[model samples]
Target: MSEASNPVVEGSLRERAARRLPSHTFSDLLVPVSSALDLAEGHAAGHAQRVTYIATSLGIALGLDAPTQLACNYAGLMHDIGVVPAGAGLGAYTRGDERMVFASLPLLSPEEAAVGASDSPEIVIERIVDHVIHGARTAREFGLPAETIKGISAHHEHWDGTGYPHGLKGEDIPILGRIICLADHIESMIDQAGPLLGRRNLPLWLNQLSGIEADPNLVSVLRDLASGDQFWLGLFSADLPGEISLGCSRLREPKGMRLLGFSESLSQLVDSRFSFTVGVSARVARYSEALGRAVSLPDLRLKQLRIAALLHDLGQVSVSERIMAKPGILSVEELEVLRNHPAYSRDVVAGIYGLEEVADWVAAHHERMDGRGYPDGRAGNEIPFEARILAVADAYVAMTSDRPHRPRADDADAQQRLRGAAGSQLDGDLVEIFLRQVVS
Candidate 1:
């Protein structure tokens, strides 16, 4: 598209500078355009877009100056840029994911990166939040402004003075940060549950939260909007695009391969992080990658799939080393624990960053095609392709490799079992693809 056709906000600040400002004026471009790009990690994937949207709304609502509004707009978009994802099984999820979206993405330069360089007091707090808080000092590595850093660092402080990391009381919170706290929480609750209260009395629900989790004034504003038909119409119009998300499939295949390698590394780390029954993790990692590639699955997808495959059996780690190491049949409790691991893995993975997108697949690896699977008993399309592939690979590897609980089944026996289970216990097409490769 031509320059005139471009949305003014869409282009890099540097590019926009050349067209709209004096050609050689470097002062206007405070930060490099590339750094801005680095500030958002896969922006389309999560709430960062909505957070920016609402923060803009809040800026307009507060009637801030153009410069401050523009700064807030960019800062809000990148506020959570320092989240360091350690994925489920070894970590947990929180409102922090919003912070990390901007915090953790690789930046263009260390010296001037938004997460770097702060010889100032304002930078001191920002440094504490982004790095010491998450284990990576992004604000120090990037030259983020003090005000911008302070706004993000304090976005979580409560109006009631009970907030974390710093017990800053109400009004003590920076205006921009307080507004962000307002916007972030409002968006979070709606996203977690439905925007509207479930079949209950609407006023009762909105009324209950007014003084509790939500700020009263903000709630009042929302209340007015919710009570009116025009607001409802506006909301309905906003959602007309149908919010089903789109993943970047253009490089998904290649990225999946890279992730496959990363998953192998991760799996190896996990295996080493705790005790393990055998050294079969390498084999598992390799074949999962092979299986994914064999099916024409992209590497990014395969990486997610490989993560599932690597960690799916981790719940078995909890089943008592004695039971896991025992050659005999397990007791009822042991069997129940074993049965629950598929779901347990999901919970474990959901807490970690970089792993949010893959948790369900890991959780659903044992689900049968006929919906007879454990955990949530999901089936068909509900069972992601990653789970399907991992299930087949797990079965193949488990059947052919000796487990502490059982001896290995031969290749022939494993093949027969897979073939027999197709369309019932296993995804038929996946099994077919797997066997075809193994046989040939």
Candidate 2:
């Protein structure tokens, strides 16, 4: 049997992860996504909760057949499952999506790379707009219902019929799908305004969205829900179990974050202790944001891409200065070791459950679409969008940054080379965007 399918003995990694994370439930999914969205962008900070309320309210208004409403509620809360730091200020995943995708690769195993590579990246990316591409089937593996799958799958579709996959419209859209779509959009808008923001003028905003992208009927119910004095009072009310329980979440999430954080930190600690590597860890996080923004992406997505771009070099963090500073190309063995660093980076982050998404991209920093890249030589679609975006960032950062053997490339020259590598190694879209930023 392939190693990817093979079960390995769980030891340090699985043991600690199990100890920290909670058992899976429809509820556990809500917390992490809410937290990450808050971290990313806070426009409508309670996007999840509001989505829940709006969706269920619409469900009640339409008399959603049965279990479908339940599915809508659950799917709306946890739809953006793969995003890391799922919090406010995420900036609608503008730039750093590529970066986040980059960070996710290394987290995949050789087996995963093979699986990702098994399907052509072009084919997979084509499916990205459709429900089948991103997490539809994977969600099914987790045992979600057909309605939930349909709701989540079509969440990205628009009412004007301009959305991806099969463009269903108006009443043609599944009732659950329509409810989720409106709930997610309104909730995100609410997050931008504080709890009071929604109170001040949410009715106007709800009215504005009617028939544009959201279902008109669903929008009206949302207006009705907000028209009450109890809208914010009900959601933020002290008695609600979700918010009340989140009081101590900050301290709790770190336990998961640390699992991944330590992998990077551990290498630095080891390197510093042995005096092997050349750079510092804290220094990387603060500076990498600029490097990440060097490419064109949304501000929210850029934040993560920068961190991953900063940490993309983390594999080299613990290498000996001798090896790091070596003048010429290295022996085959040295190159092999260099490739393993991506896996090292991923292993570090994988310990943190929240970072599992990030780890997958980070672990494959060196992989290529042509199947020639290393650590695992995962080609094409085997790599994720975040990883693909990150691969470009890594190249951009490495080329521009000063290295032991070579001085940084001139800005003009570096930009040209970045554009040239698109598709062969880096994503053409990312390369084009990065160049535009440089030119701008």
Candidate 3:
């Protein structure tokens, strides 16, 4: 994973991000991509959403206008987008969760926490200081506004001048950055606290960071916002992402090709998290779209099919690499966890606006046509045709590509096995169509 940081765009990240309007809103693309980042840690599920809510609400409380508030909201959602892959990789080799180390390293002095004291100092420094830089770049790539990109780049800056990748102190830090810093830390505290207790101790949690960690002015705003029951209610609500989606205009634009590019970017990032799964999504996407065309699917349906193919395996990030790379057969328990990835993938995609249908197809990709699949037993027509196409594409890619347990399959052998499973394990007609396309 590259720990390189993007130089802050001179004018605005938001302007750069808005240069192109994709088929869907930026968040529609970003929320699912954020899922991959959120899943990088074992304990941080939904952390991005919660932080975004807190930051945006704080932005509102601070009397920022709706556009600036929306920018803050985008900043919150993607603040840590760059940290996950490298953080996950670092943690895998370190003694414990390196996320905590990365978060706290900025605050600690040289003797207290030597940055390079651990294994692989170069990579460690890159992970620590460059996340915000890379995050800004990602937002730029995703076409977010300049303010949003700057906020993402500066979210980790400390009030006391100790933060990394340019530690501007006090009021010098961008206001959006300051808001997100508070939101990001507060969310971490709430996560660290058990759910029931976290809500109860919100005041204490806010107080802990007032002076050194967060800007005191923003902390005051957060305190005011925290006083309202509606604030907490909204934060914990099942529809928080929906509520957030309604407020942000930048995330609502409909640009089909940009949305497709958004999915491709996310798939590449997700694929990078695993050593073996690189390029799997792209191949599946190509095959799935070709199969869709061969079957004479409409253009809109073809786009949805492609998006689903790109994101089909995002949930696997949550599964342990150990289990995924195991050379032998998995135990029943391990297998169960692995099989639940599609459900996870569905939840991730569904959280984004306008991708709910695509989420359904992603969830159904693992289902068997004969009612024998693991996650859901939907049989035959019960599975969406798009999903059936996805299943065949994913399965073929898996078989033909190298696996930890077996060498890549020859085309004839792969086709024979796929043919054997057609009616029962896959959709027979789709399989036939797909095979014909491949042969041609």
* Order by lDDT, highest first: 3, 2, 1
* Candidate 3, 129-221: lDDT as tens digits: 666787788778777889999898888788898786797899889989888888878877777776678778978877878878799888888
The sequence of per-residue lDDT tens digits that candidate 2 reaches over residues 244-353 is 22422422322223322323433233233122233443344433344356644456554455445445554443233334455688888767655666775665445333
Best by lDDT: 3
Runs off by more than 4 Å, candidate 1: 1-266, 269-276
Error of 3 at 22 (Å): 10
For model 2, give the 10-residue run with minimal summed lDDT: 84-93
Candidate 1 structure quality by residue, lDDT tens digits, 1-440? 77756777455755644433112111112112112222222232335545545565566666776556655554554455443222111211122222232333222121233333233324333433343233112332344445556666777666676554475766677776676666666544454455454212445544654544335665565555456565434333444112211111111211112333333443443343223334456666566678789888754566666666776664443333344444688888777767875665665455444566677888888888899897888888888887888788777776887665667888889899989999998899988888888544
TM-score: the better of candidates 1 and 2: 2
Q: TM-scores for all candidates?
A: 0.41, 0.42, 0.82
C-alpha local distance difference test of each model: 0.52, 0.53, 0.76
